[model samples]
Target: MGAVTSSMAAKFAFFPPTPPSYTLEEDEETGKLAMSGVPRRENVDVVRIKTKRATDVVAVYIKNPSASLSVLYSHGNAADLAQLYELFSQLSIHLGVNVMGEAPMLPYIVVRQVK
Candidate 1:
């Protein structure tokens, strides 16, 4: 029963874009990472962090020189980093705070039945 519920929930909770919204690229010379088709920003950095589950999660960090606070923005399951890149940048600039947006990992929520 729990398995069936989990399966149904999984279907509704995740909606990864087909073909993916963007691809990660690394500069051969500088070793810097960027998302394809997104304009490069000197204040923004693209990084990947390894989770305990061994999943690599992509995150975007936007820096503001006047920032006295930082925010960790976790987007909704239906959206990806590419979709919210502009918002994150704007927030960092207008709010004068650093913004870090963590991409959603569907596999991070794999449902397990308890014994």
Candidate 2:
């Protein structure tokens, strides 16, 4: 689809499920990052880029990547951005690069990365 309206963008930007906050709470006892009962790290930011084609939008969750580029994809093939968290974490650890994510808006710079 084409670009969304400013009104719609504002609505989703302030939606309950997705907000403009970068919060990662690490457990003092466990020394791990989590939100509620789930691990919070390197999760993909799913977007609706292909809303017209009805295909899943790609969101590459990479460690403090220097840059991000686009990739052409067919209708039914896509990777689960969230599911690759562990692997992305490993990549960051090995490469010694900070990891961040990009969805509809822009590539977010992770202020405090996961250790």
Query: In terms of TM-score, which candidate is strongest?
Result: 1
Output the worst ten-in-a-row residue range by lDDT, candidate 1: 106-115
Those runs of model 1 whose alpha carbons end farther than 4 Å from true positions after fitting are 1-14, 104-115
Q: Write the per-residue lDDT of candidate 2 for residues 1-115, one digit (tens) a residue.
A: 3356877876666443233233334445655433222244454332234557464333443434543432222322222234444665666666655454333322331223344
* Model 1 agreement with the true structure over 1-115: per-residue lDDT tens digits: 9999999998888866655567777777666778766789999998877889787678899999999999998754566777789999989988999999987544532222222
Q: Candidate 2, which segments miss by more than 4 Å at Cα?
A: 1-38, 42-46, 51-54, 58-60, 65-78, 97-115
Candidate 1 residue pairs in clash (backbone atoms < 3 Å): none
Error of 2 at 47 (Å): 3.8
| TM per candidate | 0.74, 0.30
lDDT of each: 0.77, 0.40
